[model samples]
Target: MSAMTGELAMCGASVETLFEESVEPVVELVLGGQSARVALFGATVISWRTGARDRLWMSSLSARDGSAPIRGGVPIAFPQFADQGPLTLHGFARTARWRLADRKANLDGTLVEARFVLARSAIADTQGWVGDFELRYTVRLGVRRLELELQVANLGSAPFDFTACLHTYLLLDDVRNVTLHGLSGLEYFDKVAGRDRDEVNDAIRVEAASHSSGDVLGQRAEGFVDRIYRAGGERSPLTLQHAASGETYSIAQSGFPDTIVFNPWVAGKKGTKGPDFDDDGYNHMICVEPAITREGSGPIRVSPGSTWAGTQTIQVL
Candidate 1:
């Protein structure tokens, strides 16, 4: 939505033309008949409110700018390591420009499919950190379903080793009210335990007791959460099912090794002012992320002239 560009168009019933104008890019989405807004910088679908009658699928913050800004929902970084790589937070892929690859009709033309492709820059000699990789993102919407796919290919001459992930912050009516399915038996790190090891004795229940301690400890234990697991043993289409609305979000990934869950209810995380971040500040959004590393530690090793591919699809049920 760069202002320098021009106007945008509304292709629905209005079939109206509008300027694609905004300081930051903005994209409107109609999925499963849901009204969702995605940002240009993150390519993230932030607020998903179905038919204006249903509650927002995620939360938002009251920005000083007058936008009922969805605070904590959306996909985070890509092509960068977290806590481990020299690259900045979440990596550089989020802010880069992507092109519309294709558009086709479905749902008897009631729905549309748009594909976007991201490739390495033409000036690779200057940009050192970013890998020579191509990412294919496809977004589709129907009257009752929404689907998104991310496919990546390594294009460097040398096999590269790197960690990767799709970080999604999902809005929830209440975090404590929901139970995430499909991750019961897998081993997970109880971030509340810090550097310590603890068994998940509580049967991985939805409202299983939650805790936090100290400033650092409390940030994790109290009202906040971060968890990671290996995806080697799970079924292909992992799911995060919301019981109340009977809405199921399924995530399928290939060529990746891990998944992470994080919810920051405190200030820095809530993007608030102080330390005790109100976990539900914007609303209750949970992140079900798939990655090749946990917190950016173990990177996928690549050999020169070798190409690797990773994919994740989000489909509604």
Candidate 2:
């Protein structure tokens, strides 16, 4: 119920009360010309707009009543990524409700930040995850950029291992015209191919199937792509460029050792483009996730009373 507003700068945080009865309150952060919306249902950032354009992609068919996980935007995968563990797919974090701990704007109206918290008790009983844990997620909105940080604290008496990922869906003018850089010279686990492979190209491009008969080796066909690149905890940033509009984005992550690139173009063998996702949703969005996971190596371990943190920053260029 705490809300603040300003005039000239138009900077502040406010909860959208209209949906209070259907879903958790959504906190909207505004600073200057930039704005972002975070739904407390999953502590998910559903929208981030800068330069009058939305940088984050959200599915039109996504659930807004809190009955299920929102299909797009930045979904937090905690305690488990996908079906890697005994828990449900992507764990219960994305469907669990979170609390809005705090929100504030900078005195100068140049930045706004909001924090959300989730405890183990909020998880569903069917998830069966009994770890005493607490998750803190912070979203900061600034000029032409958005920052997302996640911290997981083990509050139990014993050590625990888990996998986490900030599943970010970047909105694009066209996925076929985008090229991603910084994954070259790295090894990755190709989920689609079900094998481990090495990335040889410095710039990866996604091309439509009709562009060529899959002649290019490194070029990704306009089909399903699911690969996890081993980042080795590198602090370098990945660059995504849209050839049509010349718009670019710099993606940087810290404390996350892996990056996942995914797109489910034209419902094929994977059948991932379900009812929650539109038929052409994959054409305009690409998921570039920062994760703390190792395919066969196992999950990250945290000792009792310890905390693990990871952050992802997206800047418009």
Candidate maximizing TM-score: 2
**lDDT per residue, candidate 1, 1-317, as tens digits?**
33211111233411111235433454555533554454544455445455444323344332212132223444545666455566655665555555555555442435555566767772223235746677667655555445556666677775656666666666666666666666656666656456533324332333323443546554434555666676632545666667677777666666666777666545335543333234444236567776776542367765655555555555565
lDDT comparing candidate 2 with the true structure = 0.79
lDDT per residue (tens digit) for residues 203-278 in model 2: 7765454223442334434466778888734735999999998988999999888888888676421335557887
Worst 10 residues of 1 by lDDT: 8-17
Go through the candidates in order and give the C-alpha RMSD of each one to the true structure. 5.8, 3.8
What is the C-alpha local distance difference test score of candidate 1? 0.53
All candidates: TM-score: 0.72, 0.89
Off by over 4 Å in 2: 1-24, 208-222, 232-235, 268-271
